[model samples]
Target: MQYKPASWLAAIPLAAMMGVCVGQAGPSQVGPDPTLPKPQRGLLPDMVIAKPAPWGDKTPTVPDGYTITAIATDLKIPRQTLILPNGDILVAEGKGGNAPNLKPKDVIAGIIKARGTSSVKGGDRLTLLRDTDGDGNYEVLTFAENLNAPYGLALVDNNLYVANQDAVVRFDYQPGQSKASGPPETVTPLPSDINHHWTKAMTASADGQYLYVGIGSNSNITERGMTAEVDRARVWRINARTGEHKSYATGLRNPTALTIQPGTDQLWAVVNERDEIGPNLVPDYLTSVQEGAFYGWPYSYWGKNVDERVRPQDPAKVATAIKPDYSLGSHVAALGVDFSNEAMGAQFADGAFVGEHGSWNRKDPVGYKVVFVPFRDGKPFGAPVDFVAGFRDKDGTTRGRPVGVTVDPKGALIVADDLSNTIWRVTPTQAAKSQQPVAAAQ
Candidate 1:
């Protein structure tokens, strides 16, 4: 897990960054108002890259009431998943991002990050899984082929939309069909230029009239310059019916996952914050997506706390930064999130499930599992409870990395593990047999 310090790290003064703590953050770092520590710029940033480990007969550990199963294996880098109306599951498999490394540190960081990820090539297609006998076992089938690194998917009014690395494409679907009937049509093109944060996370409005796309910044703190960040780090609201798009909000560095809170039209996002200042200097968060609100990227983090490294700082923008609603801890790399439902059982019925893809840096590893953050009155509160874990062994070796999480209406949690090229289905112990009508009851 140790990495030789890059020669460029010598530029940082040891004294300025030496005193900060390098272990896991306490509870104060897990909720709203996370205690922000002083930025600790270090010589190489205490690099910890988890080497790949085999799972063999091991599986992720869920809470006592639930059991986890690998419904589909040997995928092509599954990143996100969607549950269809007819009880089918759609898997988005791909990897992208062509952001050129701005400095030597970028290259070094990239090399180290790759060590923890799946080496398989992206399928670049949508795969459908059908529970043919109304049982847990799934029959894998191809829904569509030849996609451009499809990452985010949504279905509205029989129109399936996929957020590709460069554009939003749509496919017409009919109930019970296991595959797409025709080729995908581009709804709109996205800002693909130098996609430092290539994931175009997406979600549709509850009414199915609008599609909100979360576009990330072109560089960490705009090192690529503001010109490269035009129309980046913001959510775009697209008219689902007409294909027209406009900026809905601004300054969110990398909103990795987006969802409409189960009962409300309000959009929510799990954002991945900037890094390198300190392991816990800036915390990744889950927040309500407010229209026309700026969440502060590059200039500030966690609302109004200025990051000194962003050149030509915008004090005005910093002042307008909207503080996030909840913090999910730093460098957790939450790649997936879905609001919980009745099928998840009472304890998890009113919350959101976050799939932390695990961290690639920091003195100690964090994440590598799925967690449930309870919510009341549609607002998140309390510390996150580990619902699916054991992806990282006690020795810090990476076994699997969870990406997108989806709550199946038929009573289960669908998890995408790109690190192992698998799709895991987690259901309450014996709950599926008797809880078939639970979602409707609620």
Candidate 2:
């Protein structure tokens, strides 16, 4: 597949092609250091296919030994995610827009009746999990309400950290504790101005010493109208204990999901590109982040290629910026990302899974399901393969949309569906290990 360069005169393979060497880090060392807490033993809610989902044109299927079950369903606009130690999933539900329950045409009428907003308060937040069968299902859990517009979540020891619209907060969380009761503690006040709801996306480093937070640009590449500091689209590293912060990397438009690759300790981010260019022009991307490297945003894109649409107030610095590693098509709106460090059934022995939230800018929307980007030697392989599909209908209508994705303790792929308000689990087949090509497995 050929990617269109911003300038016709530009050459392809923007960077020197590195040899694709492959290796695997031991599973035991997949995540953070030993000081970090172990995986939670909380029982996850029993996720069963309640009824036939209106699977559109594509039928959703998993490996033979695995099944896709719902952890919880009927949720409001679920945004980012954090899976608790007790098997429960904490979700940041963004306020409503034109969604599955309502027709797109009727969305406008409903918005007006909502008094410009749903009765669901902007601060309303909830927890979804189950404690089924005294085991891995987090079925028996309480729903907590009244949280600021939270987007990112992390678990440190016994505490749950939440990134609200303006700050990063915490709460005491016990496996069986009821969510309706515990009081949240304010951990750190994030940089939040009213002009831009700096949707904070966060994740703790493998060692747990640092917490990385993503603060998106205030406007669509406008950089909050600041002429001096154009480095607003960036990820910050904060002392998990002290809250002292410093910029980790800059020049990202809206990096939604952040993760550190297992074993390699490499940082990766999935970003939403600037919009209003032709639907298929500006591409949404996923890339391995290098410290101190600047990814061109308002001033440029795909690495230092200036977008004529937005006149770069500072043209001198545009030529030296860095570009992305993988292009997820134009307008696919790639969001949540997870590395398959655990043996997830078998097909994904060494790779990362990403959730493309689907596209709206294009005439024909794509990316409603989860896709796998296989990696070797700490980089993306051939291309992204379809992992779990079936969100859209035959008539181009959607009944479900994927948002956040994670790998459960059982090694199953868990995906968060915002439109249907559910968590879908994809279990692997027993043959996963043996199914890998002999040489590839080695």
Candidate 3:
């Protein structure tokens, strides 16, 4: 037990016996056409969670001409962030999921996974940060409290929407207010029967006429039975004026983070794909979501590649499943995505930054850092580039795990590092040196 978890120890030989390809280890499994290695199941997948460590005086590394700053610290498990009209930042701080373990393997897996995370309890609140004078120094404030595991935030006109674990709530807004005037009213309720994947990523339509919610599947691969999966594994289209919602698309396993592509109404997501088949079988993806589309889930993956794990599988459904637009590599565990602009400097100005929370299912871990997936003509065209690194080291010690990435209007990237309980802001080196004060809100 001191050297390795029993399940992981048992899984080593199985992987070798199956001859799972190790060539897809690093970057080869990235981009549009990643090599899909044959799936291999074990008694349990490799459990390689990084032991949590302190950042101390160290910060995440960025490319040349850029700087990384800790804008806020000592947070309560911050998950997502939103930038207000007046330059204020609201951080959603919480984690919510209570799916009962279906087997001993799940219970063991949970214990192994907890080691790489922060020990803080979920804040269930929103923390606000403002640069009143536009000087880079931000004063932290509490914007809202007593929330039910809120994970998503959106602003359309004067209404601010918060997507909590069980519902989407709304509050009237007036830009500079540091706190909510009152309690939020529920815009619509979300399915919460068994939240194996509880994070509800959300965004507003360009015209503010509708809201899109990413509801994840109840279990990893429908182990909870297909009955528990109703209204799960798909994005929901909700009327902004009312609480009505309908399934926008299906077959996505866990659409963890969602956003509207800048300048278009197209919805895009960074999904966390299924696990335990093999280290490199299913590549997690970043894809443009269609109105009525299905990207393979339990029955198949990456277009008609059938997964025999699913029982009573629907062949027709598998036939209809479409491949994702871009692959972010298998088991990256991507949790956040945001489109970048020139404010982040010229090299990274035109793409989406994704927060890969890192992996726990492989011998050689992938994704414990933030990556930039380049785009061309509004579509992701190339392999992902690591924008921020040094989260996990060679010894498997992690000081941070990035969850949500936000592109600030002023040309900086706001990153949420849940393991460190910190919020990091990345910007151009010149901007960091300047620290120019912003005009105070009137």
Highest-scoring model, lDDT:
3
Clash pairs, model 1 backbone: none
User: What residue runs in model 1 are displaced by over 4 Å at the alpha carbon?
Assistant: 1-27, 430-442
Please give the clash total of every predicted structure, in order.
0, 24, 6
lDDT of each: 0.86, 0.63, 0.87
How many angstroms is residue 342 displaced in model 1 relative to the true structure, after the best TM-score fit? 1.1
lDDT of 3 at 25: 62
Put down candidate 1 lDDT per residue, 163-226, tens digits, no spaces: 9999999999899889889998999999998888899999999999999999998887888889
CA-RMSD of model 1: 4.4
Per-prediction TM-score to the true structure, in the order listed: 0.92, 0.76, 0.92
